[model samples]
Target: MGRNRKWIQICILLAVVILGGWTIASSVLDKTEIPKVGSKAPEFTLTGLDGKTHQLSDYKGKTVVVNFWATYCPPCREEMPDIQKQAAKWADKDVVVLGVNVAESKVTAKNFVDQLGVTFPILLDSKDKIRREYGVLNYPTTVFVKPDGKIAVIKEGLMDEAYLDRTIASVAAAGNGNK
Candidate 1:
């Protein structure tokens, strides 16, 4: 009886270890699953402030700039104007910058847009589905998608004009091949 009980205890311990290992491993794998430099950018559909439906797939064959932001993020506020300018600068280049408002109300986002004078489409992620789909954890995160819908760059934090220009140019110039 003693040996049987000991074997059962051992089995329980082994099960616990396996479960723990699986938990840790799955979390690590999930973290790595966030789209990388060469991965296919995840597709999403969200409504824009223009009362139009915008889907990432809709912009295929054009270089896309998916900018995740909120009105309250200071760096986002700082970089807003530059994004607006770049959108205009690169419009003829077949590049489009999409401002994905991170769960902000239309009133608040519209206020910021009005103040900043940005003409780009402001897609509202009211439920933050788009942000979570892209694994965006921070404000001012920019996902530069290549013409073929693969990610060219994933930049987090404020971006100056130079960084935006360089990244957009690189992605626009780079085809569906390696980044």
Candidate 2:
């Protein structure tokens, strides 16, 4: 009877340990949701491909598209051309498109940009500080900031050219109206 009781106690203790561990693990592994529209976009300063520093607040009077991406992400690669095209179209306007590469080396990002023929500014987040500040849980996440420095839109995953164009136009229009 004593041996049986000891075994039962051990089993209960093991079950509690397992259950507690699972609970903690699940919470830690859960991905956080990216910020939503109408929120103040997190400010950051990162080095662009031209070796110049770009700050989110620097484009205060203009609309900005801040895209978080990486070289290894398929979705990020898919949206590169679209972002490049949009940047070209809005080059003369009061608009800036910043492609922030998260946790990747300068050489890797440069190679990817050259291969893809992308002309837009690709900023480097070497320490992933901006990623954590923005709660970027997925690659190819884009946040559209209005001229007022508030987030106007948040797009996750891959976005096509048409969608980006429309979003840019809308944001530009809004900025113009607010001016």
TM-scores for every predicted model? 0.80, 0.79
Best by TM-score: 1
Model 1 TM-score is 0.80
Q: Give lDDT tens digits, candidate 1, residues 1-179.
A: 99999999999999999999999989987774777888999988899999999999998899999999999899999999999999999998889999999888999999999999999999999998878878999898999989888888999999999999998888888863443
- What residue runs in model 2 are displaced by over 4 Å at the alpha carbon? 1-34
Q: Go through the candidates in order and give each one's C-alpha lDDT.
A: 0.91, 0.90
lDDT of 1: 0.91
lDDT of 2 by residue, 58-136 (tens): 8898999999999999989988998999999998998899999998889999999999998888899999988888888
Clashes of each: 0, 0
Q: How far is candidate 1 from the true structure (C-alpha RMSD, Å)?
A: 6.0
